[model samples]
Target chain A: MSTPRPLTLIVNGEPRALQVEPRTTLLDALRERLDLTGTKKGCDHGQCGACTLHVDGERVLACLTLAQQAEGRRITTIEGLAGPDGTLHAVQKAFLAEDAFQCGYCTPGQIMSAVACIREGHAGSAAEIREFMAGNLCRCGAYPHIVAAVQRAARALEQETLA
Target chain B: MMDFSYARPADLAAAGAALAAGGMALGGGTGLLDLAKLGVARPVAVVDLTRLPGLDAIQVSETEARIGALVKMSRLAAHPAMRAALPAVGQALLASASPQIRNMATIGGNLLQRTRCAYFRDAAVGSCNRRNPGSGCAAVGGVTRGHALLGVSPHCIATHPGDLAVALVAFDAVVETWSPNGQRLLSVHDFFLLPGATPGQEFALAPGEIVTGLRIPLAPVARQARYVKLRDRASYEFAAASLAAGMSLGVDGRIADLRLALGGVATIPWRARSVEAALIGEHPTPAAIAAAAALAMREAEPQPDNRHKLALVPALIERTLTDMVGEPA
Candidate 1:
């Protein structure tokens, strides 16, 4: 059972092959095997939202997901949100402008979750944003700022789609 | 987490064989993986059940709703027609875990989820009977707030910690399972077992059997239903006490049928049969609803810390019924 098996993961639009033990979490695979450390490990378990990542376009807790379980799925981390030209995503830009974080520890997870919230049409208002993004815990008490950023980004993204 | 080998079974036979070889079935891996990391669960071989085909379909017919075991929690919660048909199912699902978890957790996994007792999760914590049988129940005396009052034994008092099972029990859902012998249908009420003396044996799934799907009869009571979850926070947390109610009233203002089930207050998703029996054929009032709800907790044995649930459960039922059906003048 301790033996490592090879598995290919399509992360950030590129397929990367790695060997991982069946017990190795997807969070560890991203940080240790691929050096995609943008995804922080808060609890290294599912308790904290620090390891939330997109699996096949849906946000999921990577810490609870086995690396082998994600073999056939497309995974997107915090690093994949920005463009190759280093252009920040709308949510990222809003996060920076609104100072949606204080210590910036939970920022990556917050931003990734905010992106999905808007994409899922759950960022319609302050209350909606708060309810939808409740999974990403911000211990810095930046919830008000986080809500404001989601609202700002949601409007901007809507305008971009309209434009 | 201990190292384990993984397998993807293409069909039921392969899954059965995998289970026969001492492999634990992995659904969304939310509960199992979390427990494995905590050293609560250690499976030498892991059988990934998500990749199995024909088990992800969500079919709603005129008379029934069949939800495959592999159907993600969010997938069913977001189904428009299903939501309109069986509202309690969606309500319970939405009231459950965070959006990120709902996206990954499967219905089958939710049904068989382990208790959320802190003693069960922490390896170095006080003695936990559920984690290691006969170790002694830590929740019995220490921090008994979240412990079960409805189905408590000296051995275990762990709450079921699931909302879907509560609503399924209310609407007469059937547990559909598959094994080498053939398909078997067990009522949701009988699927879950009480701790009694053996807290380790929780569910009624036979060895090497797999839960294929859940069959819910679209009873008339299901047409009008409500789920009220009272928790510390609004979302992303387990319920302190939750109620799922489905009621139908005749034109004469008398109750035609009523169904009730409670969560977060019982060891299993508890169907309040005595409560339902008291309300049937009678017009609902706040006082009558209050008294009827009391019948559900007749056998409750709450500790000093959790005695508040005695007042909370009846209030949830009374308020939900009053809001659903106006008092008969």
Candidate 2:
């Protein structure tokens, strides 16, 4: 094995520095090294979006991203969504209100993706939401509720922006 | 994944030098990283191309649209200029994999994505000719519902799992690349090699050659182009059979020009020139479209489980053409 290299990323608005192997994926760096395990690793491959997170405000599959690629970039995992005072973000609150999860394994990634979807203005309709959120797979079959939660969260985010 | 050295080169010359030494060019890493994880690809070094400047520009003019190879699929699909110039390109990209994937997958990476054959993906399966040359193809006799039907060789029948290449081929796009020999341009048709005896040799690009950009010449009928993809699910899944069709109508309601290409039915993105030839000056009636569609797949050779593609290919072609001409679906 090669020597670990020092890498730095502005993760969740904090400058995080860590030593990582060249092959360490962003998903592993977040979950294993940083102890932010909210991003799940379903399928490990890019086929499943269980490791979805935001890189510079765009939703990307963390498992497919090498840690070195995230260098000097802002990465927002599900752990970073809520306020520092433990106040759930609007999307999290909407997901809770809408009951958008069952087993909840895929919820973190789904919620992360949903927040980005709303921010990107792709949550205009339920069908559009489903099309955009197709990356995150929920085996528990909470798609209908998940769509509802995204709609509710989009509205809340809009109101928050207005207020 | 294997332990390999990674180098992020900010210049094309550095990336080219690394690639010339047998290091793999890493773009987005959506597909290559997964293959590395599966042990299908074992590179000694990875040349990261993300930091290279001017490789992600999308310039659209009156005559042609030049898209950087590193442009993300999501960005290209949502670009208003591309939508106005070439709707098929956007449609093909949007009809592809899911959103998060689209955000990370590069245009060059999409064109060079590996086959999604079950046998090829599972390196442990031990019988994919593409994965291990001369090992024999497991999909030939095993489960092959998704195998190629048009350009299948006895050695391999894995379908090319890309929608963008199909649309590019239909529009006659040109691929620009930089290699050890400097810069060059290749037509999309000549870019993807047919999987014959050497199923592993999928691209016409030389070792260490990095695709830099793609140029799609604009046509009068480009905005009328349509990409129709039929998959198992409405989203995220690979195409079962897809069609990228475009046409321009003359004043007399005749076909002025036409372009057609098929996906998920061939070893490469299959250009339907036969269908295009049959419809080029003919009035695009239902019978004429059916005849042209029939000509499109007349040379199809389907295996045991994939005979449905023979019918599906022509049906998709006819439907796509009909829809392109503003006929009722």
Candidate 3:
């Protein structure tokens, strides 16, 4: 057997070094190794976005990314999206207000993606948000509420900036 | 999962060199990693290209656009230049996979991604020609609702699963590849070959070759281009049938030039040269477009479950052309 490779990843703004197999996905490293269970794994394949997270401020499928590839990159999970005082991100608040989930298995990934969607300027219109969020499948069929949450979050973020 | 050694190269040349050392190249790891986890692509080594530099830019010039291999599909679609120069390509990218997959999936990976054939995905299923050549295509007589209707061979009938590649073929884009020998450029049409006889060989990339960038030529016709995809669902599903149509009309509503390519109906991106040849210098009327659309699908030989695709092709082409013609001046 070959020796395990050492990789250093910045998860949730914290630097973590670990020895991992070459085949370990970022999702596996996060959930199994680092104990960040917020990023859920639905389809290990790219078809589902339950393992969504932010790699350097952009939403990426953690399940498809190799842990070694994320070395030195800033990774933001759902647990890290809150402020220093643990105040909810505007998107998180909107999701709660709109009840954008049912079983909530996909909510973490959805919320992570929703925050990124707004930050990336994809919350312009409901259609745009729907298009951008198409990757995160809600098996519970909560699409309308999810879209509404994104729209509300966009408005809230805009108002906060004005205030 | 099978054990494999992995190496992350700092640049394209190093990545190519690692690939030359008898390892499979990894990009985005969406497709390849999944296959590896399922013990499908059991290579001895893996060359990681995620950290490779200079392969992540979307450069737009006045006359052309160069998209790096590592450029993510979401970024490519959202890029202002791509939206302006080749809206059809952007639309196709936007229509592919989902936003999360799009963000992680690179343009090169999207082109090189394997088919979504159920038999191919499940190695224990009836032998798949694409996974193992000459093993016989289960799709030929098996469930083939999604099989190819054109440019297929007895060996394989797997339809290419890329929407963006189909549109690229319609735009006559060139694929720029780098190898140990030197750099070579190939038209997208030639880059992806028909599954004739050799179904195992998909892309035309040689051993140790890396697709560095895609060079899209400057064409005014692109302004009037459209990519229309019909799928089982409105989003996040493979194309049931798709049309990428590029047309340039003269001032008097006559067709100066026309380029049409079909997806989800062929082993490769089916460039409708037959349709283009018939429509040039002809009047840009619905009747002429219909005639050309019919000509485009004339040679379509659909299998038992895929015959509906033949009917869907004409309507998709007509609608795509109509939309392109109706866009704002």
Q: Rate the local accuracy (lDDT) of all candidates.
A: 0.90, 0.90, 0.86
Q: Which candidate order results from sorting by DockQ in descending order? A: 2, 1, 3
Residue B6, candidate 1: how far off, in angstroms?
A: 1.3
Top DockQ prediction, candidate number: 2
**Which regions of candidate 2 are displaced past 4 Å?**
B327-329
Q: Return the lDDT, model 1, position A65.
A: 92
What DockQ, between 0 and 1, does each candidate earn? 0.79, 0.90, 0.73
Which of the two, 2 or 3, has more TM-score? 2
Evaluate candidate 3 and give its CAPRI docking class based on DockQ.
Answer: medium
- The 10-residue segment with the lowest total lDDT in model 2 chain B: B320-329
Across B126-211, the per-residue lDDT of candidate 3 in tens digits comes to 58777887788878788999888888888888889999998899888999898888889999988997788887889999878998
| Clash count, one per candidate | 0, 0, 0
Q: What overall lDDT, based on C-alpha atoms, would model 1 receive against the true structure?
A: 0.90
Scored against the native two-chain complex, candidate 2 gets a DockQ of 0.90
Q: List the residue pairs that clash in candidate 1.
A: none
Candidate 1 lDDT over B8-126, as tens digits, reads 88889999999977999999999898888888898888999998989999999879999999999999999887887889899999889888989999999999999998888788875
CA displacement after TM-score superposition, residue B120 of candidate 2 (Å): 1.2
Winner on lDDT between 2 and 3 is: 2
Docking class of 1: medium
